[model samples]
Target: MYQLIALDLKAARKEKTTKQKESLAKIALLHQNVQSLGNSINEINQMLMDHDDCKFICITEHWKSQDQIINYGIRNFKLASCFCRKEGKHGGSAVFVSLAVQCLERSDIRSLSVVGSFECAAVKCSLNGMNFIILSIYRTPSGNMHVFLEKMEQILSKISDDSASVFIAGDFNIDFSQDSPNKQLSCSLLNSYNIQQTIFQFTRITSASESCIDNIFTNISPFVSNVINSSISDHTAQKITVMVDMNKPANAVKKRILNNERFLCRLKSVDWQNVFHIPQNDVNEQWNYFSNIFQSIFEQVFPMKTFKVTNRFTDSHHPEKIKNNIKECKDRLDVLYVISNSDNSYKPCYNKEKSTINY
Candidate 1:
């Protein structure tokens, strides 16, 4: 019986190891039409916390201005790129890339536009030594579909080389479920460059209607893809999974910092006057003697160590107080939402709280 129990324990350990390996094998990405990130930014944060495996989040219809982006920043992930609507207040797109992923905005493609009717934000990054171009696009329903397609074609033409894989995920506003001319044209345009739409299920579900407007188009198929049912927003969040080795070494510089309090305490305990009374003829020798004593005290009190430089975005500078304030505002909003129910009373309160948090 003891031998059997030991075997069972061994099997459990092996199963646990296998589970850990499987969890580390893939990186999850979420794409969603937030409609207006300003109102539901807290929900996004909660979603991220719940889905810890998600590394990247691509959002469309953010309905946010350039200034508002600062307030909607997430903790670990950095806002790599954003294309806000120039004239109107709505219809914007943004990509938040994880710090673990080395990504930079593709300014070349970003600058190219078709009268600014459509929005697109691209980032070039390497994951596990494999290079990829990730784009988040949002096409306004009012925009000319032909012009949008032509602009997309132009952008695709520029990055059509077989060097890097491309992943485009967004709310195109073109219903792929129905046999529409726009859908056909979009599919044909994508197919011309060997890009395939991976999402087939209805991303936007409503009581009256359902459609697969939100999509994930990629040149390379993702290892895992699914539509997450969420009450965070009206539309469901689409998730794509890819394997990435996050163990890549980072280029970092080390610098020393002194713990002033500890150093002062150590200095207070020393007989400074005695140490300064060194038998030296030259002023330089006396200065050197003083410096050596200071250095010894500093080293003993405040040792130095190296850490990676990971502050690549403005959000990195946000203080803990600001995070706490944001959380408090979210909690208040939740309470107000529950109390108001179907009433419009929560709108004003939410807006007021949002302004306070941003401030």
Candidate 2:
């Protein structure tokens, strides 16, 4: 099912003419459960088309059968979905993308074999030769959150190595509240991989007087930009926008290395090995140390001046620098694990054959 849909702004910007800057556009995540009355799909489409800035609209939980989907034929958008015979409705999740941006690869809608659930799929696109992967997730209601997350963790581990920029959004059906950590159940594992979790409460936000459910999480750092509490759906939809800049001078690389060193030094110096074994509770102490390190690296490496490209939005396959950064981050994680006596599960960091250690 299409839990989430994303458009590559960097790709869309290329097609814009000089006079079309005002129409640069915005991406919106409009969450809705169409099964309920008074929230027709046609109304949703009409409301979305009214937005001048809205380019891509990601819809979640369209609880309609296959027959309704084919017969209704909503206009000016491409829809993708995964359905199951639950509650006599063809419901799970679905995504809607504006017809303007071209879909580079076919949609992946199937039962993710790892878990025996008919939920989750991905769509791929190439913007300036950089690949982007957007995945949709829906955990089974009967299954424990841990079991679902474990399966999800295994499935994602295989794809993390891909160079494509990844964005995962959906109806996780799990609450991420710290008050009752048990509510976390199987979904807690996502917190381990730098995935930022934000709640989008549909049930409460629509009718009740509360706000805490539904979510969007991603490992892509700095979170780009987002709009929460938008009123497109009964479920509060969040719109996230990201900008990737790659341009730098040769001297900047050396300076960035120096910056990363300073970041490392700011933390209390400990033998790297001892630091790794810190219990989950104490991981924060270690994270404060390493997060600074990553921020330092990201700050230096992410600026467009780091690479020679003038317009990152137009250049093709220009992520050679970002690829190197991903590699460096992976290496740093490995070194931390080895030094800290932690087992190398190889899930949080991507493992590569050529990623040799340099002691």
Candidate 3:
């Protein structure tokens, strides 16, 4: 079975009675190099389910256009901004902010970004008066480092360090696990602004080689960073935990479904022998027989769930107001009917459904 295999956020909150449990940090962001997002939406969706409180999700190498990314939206996250190459073959950047968080896309940054050099999409997020900017960056392996460094300086020189905390995360194609000229130059530029690389462990590990090309750099201090298996990408995913609190959606509805890992295990445990050996030879009957077998299994694995999401700013259907108006109209019609039958003076007041009901 695919277990959660970490300090589940809910478990940490509930078990905070213990002194050690109280030290569990709040996970603020999740970043991964999803080579192709269309192929790994389920894995990312399941990860989001595991960490419902997570604020930001950034991915590199999405290989999607703006229209494609719009069509491939995540469940609880909003598309803050994204960038796709206009000239190159593949490689794109996307940033998805939690719907609960207040965020605005930085189109200015996108305008200055160079695709092969410092390809990135950024968003400015505000929570409880604290503001921070997240840059989902990606650089091609064969791309020129001078262009990357020059673009970085141009963009960084424009933004002041004191305005907001900064988080730069994604694949740079420059390994930080070992020291090199490219890494040193990149570090010098970022460190000038006090933004430091947080993930030093090798993110891409294979039988032949290992490298820390995928990384996260942030100006926020005193953070905890870890590399975990994403189960979808060859490069491991990186997550960061900070002391600050993420904005919890007081109004947004939350609904829980069966865990994906558990569902797979339950499917394997079910007995499908009866489905395979159905005695009926009729095609329709055989279809129904298999359907019933799967139906029972699905019921056992996944129960019903109910949830509602209300937008605080706008509403499409004011059902309560409409219901009250309907009730008042019915009462008026009833009174008119009673009066018309009791006294001829009020005749023809109520004859049909819409007889006297004014719009």
Question: Which candidate gets the maximum TM-score versus the true structure?
Answer: 3
Model 2, 56-101: lDDT tens per residue? Answer: 4444455555455544444676764444334554345555555664
Q: Which ten residues in a row have the lowest lDDT in candidate 1?
A: 334-343
- Highest-lDDT candidate: 3
Model 1: CA > 4 A from native: 1-25, 114-116, 244-359
**What shift in Å separates residue 57 of candidate 1 from its native position after superposition?**
1.0
lDDT of 3: 0.69
- Residue by residue across 120-210, what tens digits does model 1's lDDT show? 8788876665566788888877777756765676566556432456788888889998756567657755764567888889988888999
Clashes of each: 0, 14, 0
Q: Estimate, for each residue in 1-359, the C-alpha lDDT of model 3 and write its tens digit.
A: 13453547657766765644454435488899999999988889987787676788888999887778888878888989888887756799989998888988878677767877788898888776566788899999987776676567655644432245678899999999765656765775576456789998889989999999998888677898999887778899898878753333323322223343454345446454544465645544544554444445545544544344444222122545434434443433343233323334334333433453443
Predictions ranked by lDDT, top down?
3, 1, 2
Error of 2 at 171 (Å): 1.7
lDDT of every predicted structure (CA atoms) = 0.68, 0.45, 0.69
Model 2: residue 79 alpha-carbon error in angstroms:
1.4
lDDT of 3 at 11: 72
Model 2, residue 351: distance off in Å is 28
